[model samples]
Target: MEESPAAARWRVPPAQTALKCAAAAVFAVLAALSDEPGGLLLAAVATLGSGGLALRDLLAPVRVAADPGAVTVVTGFAGHRTLTWPEVLDVGTDERRRFLSTTRLLEIRTDDDLYLFSAFDLGADVREVADELDRLRAGGPRS
Candidate 1:
């Protein structure tokens, strides 16, 4: 069967989400407790900034795809980066405990430059995606 264009993603880790929730809660309390307007303003800024980062992360996993010839990372831009089989030279395990099954990192050395893909920023299904990318790149995807 032909592959669908929709990018598949592993969901974000619960630990990360919990941490973000905690930070937001703390920041909210700080903002509320502040007696001076400046303190409140700072707290609000921190809360908003942190929330923005979290939102960016939530959206990133939805923008990636792996195929036999290449692993395409969609940047939601006019142009996207593609890592060919040959470009993907090695995989790295970051030894970080953030997600469930994704690799720590994937190191790619293309004809032109080197690229590193880290799953620490991804959700739950990264391991499956990585394995699929490896298989497809090695042996073309099943028809």
Candidate 2:
């Protein structure tokens, strides 16, 4: 089913989610086959970490969603936090340059905290998402 025309949502893409699950599966196999104690411990840790992340992503697929009234985001471990338009102080993009690469992130600022999301987290370009958020915050049309 399609989302309502009044709201827009974004999530970790299905392919990326599948890749995370696959990595977890590989880690599980490695954990099972590891004979050395150190190797087994390492693999077990990897399995649990990746598996937990995959489960979280699967459970809360929509990382970010916004409507005319409020913006909702998936927070820690499948939890969700909703901020009304009034609570949202700013919607913008941040860029960090490291070595040869630059990372762009969508940032939502509030009185209490600043929430940042990567493209992987939003399943869309950070700039586009920020622009959409700005439009929504301004009571513009949803596109």
Candidate 3:
């Protein structure tokens, strides 16, 4: 049987989500076991923040999916955004450098605004995603 196009959604790897939850659990346990006076407060705060983020990421996740007619982006806390081929003006890659580390990002430009999607969420190479999006916008094969 052939899978539906909507079933081909892309999302952050489950391993990453598991890692975040494990890290948060470790911090939470450390916070509970901390004995230092001032250090205990800081550790507890960090545990709470980390735990919250872990829960959010696990629940919402980050995803990008494409159908024949449109693309969908779900950036966890950022909510969902969709754009049809006609709405897309251009699709390309953008790079950011900080110190010795560099990161590349996928960008989509529409008539009204430009949107950026992270490769982490797409679970694929940023360049590949950008190229595929460009092809899709040009009315090429969805794959």
Candidate 4:
């Protein structure tokens, strides 16, 4: 038997989307019930805009899915970017230490540009993701 080429598919938690939708609904209802037009309008706009962004995230999440053919990058609403093994030039990590915490990001460099993927958004360690991507890019096993 042979394994399918489809490697991994990363997506944001659905709870995040649900929370955003709930917030939007709450704000809209509050605005409708409020007597103050200015505050109502402000609340309505903020909530709706936030909801739209969240919905977009749900629809098209930031994911890096690699297969035998190519690696696909979906950056919520930004569209898809595909890179073949040869096109995946390099994979690295970025770390930033703040006042009390640190942040890590996975960086992918190609022939023409560089892309950054956040571990937080992927719900995985940046190093792990980078390693897997590097392996796939090098024509190694998907596992």
Candidate 5:
């Protein structure tokens, strides 16, 4: 049987998380090994601190199986943002970051709310994923 599109909604790619953890470990070691070493203990601390945040953000996505009635962006996560999709009204990119730089923003509108989501907090597949979100809000398939 085919899985429903709702069952295939966006979630962070698992390998991404593992890879981040591994990269952090590698960096901690390399940093600690440098001529001007960050110090083994300091590197370890840094790795743990950042790894925790990465893991948290990696798991912060709660809409992997279906789009909400509307999108809601809760920016005050103790560490990460929480997003609900059905309320999102528009998404756009701005070159304000620099002459060649752009930022993605998701503008949401609800019966009594408005908010925006930025690309800065997102990862590699941002364009494709954000496009899907756009289609979803427009009442269409992820295509």
Candidate 6:
């Protein structure tokens, strides 16, 4: 189906998805090559974990989508939660500092929940996403 011109979508980048898949493959190979039962178990667990994550990303790549009516966000594996524009109390950015590094996140606040999406999660700059969301919310031109 074709999305409306007012809609915006974001997802995990293909490169990151490929990296997860690659990690899963490497773990699978390790599992096949391991001689010790403990090593085999570890590799098997890693393989399953990474493989599941990769599959999830591949199947449900769109992490966030917003349109004139509402905003939908992936809440779990193949699951989504949508909040109408009226339910959205605020859209902004937050900074997280850990030691020498700082991470920016897009935050959406609703009546009962606060959703945060990182740049990696949205596959775009947090600031840019925030600006777009603001414009969309304000019924301004997307450009």
- Each prediction's TM-score against the native? 0.53, 0.95, 0.78, 0.78, 0.51, 0.90
lDDT of 1 by residue, 1-143 (tens): 11454223333465775677678778878999999999999998888776665665555434345655566654432235776667666533333565675335544455666544555444533444466555666764443
Q: Score residue 9 of candidate 2 by CA lDDT.
A: 91
Candidate 1 structure lDDT: 0.57
Model 2, span 50-100: residue lDDT tens: 899899889998988988899998777899999999999999999999999
Lowest-sum lDDT 10-residue window in model 5: 63-72
User: Model 1 shows how many backbone clashes?
Assistant: 3
C-alpha positional error of residue 2 in candidate 1 after TM-score superposition, expressed in Å: 15
Clashing pairs in 3: none
Worst 10 residues of 6 by lDDT: 1-10
Residue 39 shift from truth in candidate 2, angstroms: 0.5
- Candidate 1 backbone collisions, by pair: 1-143, 10-125, 11-123
Query: Distance (Å) between predicted and true CA of 74, model 4?
Result: 1.5
lDDT of 3 by residue, 1-143 (tens): 11254333556767777877787788778878889867778777777777776676676565666655888776446477887778878778889899999899888787877777676666778888776666655666556
The better-scoring model by TM-score among 1 and 3 is 3
Weakest lDDT window of 10 consecutive positions for candidate 3: 1-10
- Top candidate, metric TM-score: 2
Give the candidate order by descending TM-score: 2, 6, 3, 4, 1, 5
In angstroms, the error of model 3 at 73 is 1.1
Candidate 2: RMSD to truth: 1.6
Tell me the number of clashing residue pairs for each predicted model.
3, 0, 0, 0, 8, 0
> Candidate 4: where is the Cα deviation over 4 Å?
1-6, 76-78
The whole-model lDDT of each prediction reads 0.57, 0.88, 0.70, 0.74, 0.51, 0.88
Give the poorly placed runs of model 6, Cα more than 4 Å off: 1-4
Provide the global lDDT of candidate 2 against the true structure: 0.88
Candidate 3 RMSD to the correct structure: 3.3
Those runs of model 3 whose alpha carbons end farther than 4 Å from true positions after fitting are 1-8, 75-78, 111-113
Candidate 4: global Cα-lDDT?
0.74
